[model samples]
Target: MAEFSVTLLIDASTSMTVTADTPEDAAELAMDEAGNPSLCHYCSGKMDVGDVYAARVYDGDKEVLDTDWTAQQLAAAEKQVEKLEKRVAELEQAEQDAVKVPRGLLECYLNGGGDWVEAGHKLRALLGGGE
Candidate 1:
């Protein structure tokens, strides 16, 4: 990431009346009046801004920056996030439909005092193999 400075150019219209003997003095007074102003009855204090907007950006090396760089990064990031979210949904669905057949058969034979031969027959039937 780099640093940026943004400057906005606007237009402000104003008028001032000054009492001076010479035109040069009046010009000087008008220039000075630009910085210091009072709200007048006829003047609206709001600044007028046009539709056009522009920004000049430069890095530390005085190099010009590519404006589309951030947009490209955002598009790539969105694609990656979509792929990961799809894979996560697939894993969650598989977990919900999974059956622990081997563990269940082992527990039935060893813990329930059921015979292994009978358990094998049942396992075959449960797996859709012919008994």
Candidate 2:
């Protein structure tokens, strides 16, 4: 979801780096690049040992070191989204209820010089008032 720039310390000696969407992606890229046996097979001499260590991870300007919280974060985000959706639905229902006056009553009220008391009686009657 976000781009990360990772600086890896290879075998505690050389610097191997990669930019990816996640820290896991960066680690996989570093491992694939450093641990490939084909390069050693092609060369006559023995290859140096390399172990990938993620030295630093950056998401834009902020530094991110903890890469194990993805599942927790996703669950939290899902809950927030669900809450927002329910709030939106409640707001929509409130809006609909606010404008639920009968169309004929509204037309008559608008045409009859805005009679507030008569419109109020009509609205109360439409809403099943005893009076």
Clashing pairs in 2: none
1-131: candidate 2 lDDT, tens digit per residue: 99998755334333356878887676566656766333345442444444443344556666554333664577689999999999999999988887786664686488657996777676677678833
In the order shown, what is each candidate's alpha-carbon RMSD?
A: 19.9, 13.4
Error of 2 at 90 (Å): 0.8
Each model's number of backbone clashes? 0, 0
Candidate 1, 1-131: lDDT as tens digits:
99998655654444446666654565456556565444455543543334312221233345232224565577789999999999999999887656467776786578546799878777667778857
Stretches > 4 Å off in candidate 1? 1-67, 96-99, 103-113
TM-score of 2: 0.43
TM-score of each: 0.37, 0.43
Top-lDDT candidate index: 2
Predict model 2's lDDT versus the native.
0.63
Give the Å shift of residue 104 in candidate 2. 7.4
Q: In terms of TM-score, which candidate is strongest?
A: 2
Q: Local distance difference test, per candidate?
A: 0.59, 0.63
TM-score of 1: 0.37
